[model samples]
Target: MNHALKTYQTWLNDSAVDEETKNELRGIADQPNEIEERFYKDLEFGTGGLRGVIGAGTNRMNRYSVARTTQGLADYLKKDGQDPAPSVVIAYDSRNQSPEFALEAALVCAGNGIKAYVFESLRPTPELSFFVRRLQASAGVVITASHNPPEYNGYKVYDGTGCQLVPELAEKVTARIREISSFGQVHKLEQTEAEQKKLLVWLGSNRDQEYIRAVASVSPRSEQMKSLAPQLKIIYTPLHGSGNRPVRDALDALGFTQVSVVSEQEHPDPGFSTVASPNPEEKDAFAMAIRMAEKEGADLIIGTDPDCDRMGAVVRGPDGKFEVLTGNQSGALMIHYLLSSLKETGALPDNGAVVKTIVTSEMGAAIADRYGVQTLNTLTGFKYIGELMTRFERDGSFRFLFGYEESYGYLAGNYARDKDAVLASALICEAAAYYKGQGKSLYDVLQELYRDYGYFKEALISRTFKGKDGVDKIHSIMEDWRSRPPHDVDGTRVVRALDYLEGIEGLRRENVMKFVLEDGSWFCLRPSGTEPKIKIYLAVRKTSNKEADQALKQISEAILTRID
Candidate 1:
């Protein structure tokens, strides 16, 4: 029998597997393709943990997989021998089966004699990071797919530092997960029994209130906000996720009385019924908020992803139409606002530092330079940024002013060692209010920044590959790019190229290639760590927006041609 076929038969015969799971397997027995897809391999417990379509299979995110992954983590925690008793904080976003998965993880932890502190309901990913440190837990886990399609869900693990597990730690966890022979070996505790034993603790409003207070402290100019906020009409949509309460709570606590929530998307809906995707970066995700903004004549429209860790904004442009600001544009705006505001009030510290991913726009560094603030670049993930913050905290070398990634994730305070949408929401709205006080719009301020610091624009193209064959194709493309890099982009000479796989510029090794063009334009190609997508990041600097945009278009075409 085929390997997948044998695995399928075993599942059907295994008494430990649930009746519903066996029935689902039985229904797909005749379908060879379904069996192959589901049993080809276990849904990988990647560095971040498991993420896959939710269903009954080894290749999916079922209860068994969740329990198995938790058991692996528990074993690792015990072996590492954390001080005193080992405990973990657990949180979930408002995705289908998110709450259930969180509970399953908690019960599994309890079975291993590890205390589990779980949120009573859905919360943002960043707060999970905050609670990890606040509660002084040994580790943390959050159940969320983070703006992926409705069918997908994920589990992310964080260290006691409140940051995602770094490469070394993740590798150890992965090795432990592989040691678990079967789902049947993973133990679980009944919820009631766990609670009775005090192995399960529920986090409630006290945690929420503390988190909101921390978010409020991220604002650079609260005094100015107090005066201008009431006049600033803002439209915010949670996109059917966890942002509805905390995002609003932060704003309201900061005295932003004119904020309006998009009614259709204000509540948690697992299907994300109103939008095509829950991602804030997509324009379609802002449709309802845009309509609400137009009707209410709101000055700004902001949307957060399902996990509330990424934020996207729509501002009225010079053409009197609401335009979606790319992640680069929004990050640049926030950086400029935060730095300039602090400088004006003499609150800017000399040791302040700004951090961004290698793929993020150079405009942020330029803005930071104007303020004499240091800039640091990390590899692709926000965890790298968080790691830097922790280092700065330990040695008292540099104070982290802000950290951001081009994928709509931003963080301003050390309160949470992760990208925080609640904090970002507070700062963005406050920045809008500050600009409004000066009789200007956020878009207007962005244009001013462009004019002062040469028009810097960025574009990202993500090409997704599916299945085993597609994975092979993605690796082939990366290998080809690394082996033979292009000499130019749109006829501009390539001045330099960096292969991160070889550990260039004091950065860690990874499978990424970056090329810098003679005219100050550049592009980088890297495969997504969590998903099977190859992302191409293009950036250009010119004296005018039109020229910069045109340069990006030309360069994008040239690169895509070569890839194809």
Candidate 2:
């Protein structure tokens, strides 16, 4: 029998398997293709941990897979020379079956003789990072899909320092996971028994208060926020995920009186009925918020992903129409406002630095350079950025002023090691209020920044490939790009090339390629660590906005047309 068929038979025959899963398998017994697709391979780890379409199979996310992965993580936590009395922090978002999956992981930890700190209710991903560090746990687990569609959910693992495990450590955990050949072998405990043994502890409201205060305190422009509360009308949407309460509480604590939550999307919605996908980076995600903003005469609109780790903003632009700001645009605006605020107060750190990803635009770096702050680039994922932040704390080399990626994720304070929409929301709104007091919209300020600095435009192109052959297809595309590097793009000479697979600076080797044009335009090709897609990133910097847009378009066409 083929390996896929053999695994399917074993799972079906295992007496420990749940009846629901057995029924699912039995229903598909006649469909050999379906069986192969479902059991072809185990779910692989990625930037967001074990993520897949929620279903019953080795390749999908189910209770058995979740429990099995947790058991492996548990073994890794209890390995020799590690913590003897290991405790794990667990939090879940507002996704279907998220609570159940979280409970299963907690039980698995408890069964392995490790304490489990499970949140009493759903919370944001960043808050989980905070509590993990605050409690000094052995590790952490957060159950979230993070802007993926409702059919998906995930499990992300974090180390004691609250940062997601880097590549080396993730490999260690993967090794342990490989030892568990069957889901039936996963360690588990009854919830009541774990609680009675003092192994299962629930985090509560007091911790929420602490996290809200931390997010509230991140804004240095609180005085400005208080002054312009009346002038700045804002609309926010949680996209029916986990950001509703904490984001609102943080705003209230910062003394913003003119904030309003999009009523249709303020509650927990695992299905995310309002939008096609919960990702804030997409323009459609802001449809409801935009309509509401128009009626309320709101000056700005903001939205966060399900787990609240990413944020997106919309403002009335210079054209007098409401336009969504790309992640690069948002990052540039926020950094400019933050550095200026700190400088005016004479609190700017001499050794402060900003961290971003390799695929991110150079606009923020230019703005930071104006204030004498340094910029560091990491691999694409936020975890790489988080790992760098942890290193900065350990060594006194530089103070982490801000960190962000071109995916609408940003961080301002050291309260958490992950991207935080709550903190970002507080600071972005404060920036709006501050500029409003100066009789300027955030868009107005953006135009002024463009005038001072150069105009920068960026775009991302993603091609998806799913199913068993998906991996091979993405690999083929990447290899084609690497072996046959472009000579020129849209009449611009390719002056330099960077193959990240060979290593860049002190960072680990990554599967990415970049070609820099003579006109200061550049494009990068990197595969998504968490999804079955290869991403193309294009950036252009020019003296005029028209030139920047034209160059970005021509470059995108020249490169992307070759993919097919």
Of the candidates shown, which would achieve the greatest TM-score relative to the real structure? 2
Task: For candidate 2, list the clashing residue pairs, or say none.
Answer: none
**RMSD per prediction, one decimal?**
1.3, 1.1
lDDT of 1 by residue, 464-507 (tens): 99876677999999989888888777779999998998988788
TM-score of 1: 0.98
What local distance difference test score does each model get? 0.90, 0.89
TM-score of structure candidate 2: 0.98
Clashing pairs in 1: none
User: Runs in model 1 with CA error above 4 Å?
Assistant: 1-3, 45-48
How many clashes in each candidate? 0, 0
Where is the poorest 10-residue window by lDDT in model 1? 41-50
Q: Kindly report the root-mean-square deviation of model 2 from the true structure over all alpha carbons.
A: 1.1
lDDT of 2 by residue, 1-564 (tens): 998899999888887788999999999999999898889998887777778889888988899889888988988988832788899999999999999999999999999999999999999999999998899898999998898889998999998888888888888988898999877778888999999999999998777998988887777777766667667788999999889899888888887778899989999989889889999899999998999888988899999999999999999977667899999999999999999999998989999999999889999999999999999999887888888888889897889989999999999888788999998888888898888888899999999998898899999999999877888999999899889888888788999889999987788898999999998899999888778898999999988999888888899999988986
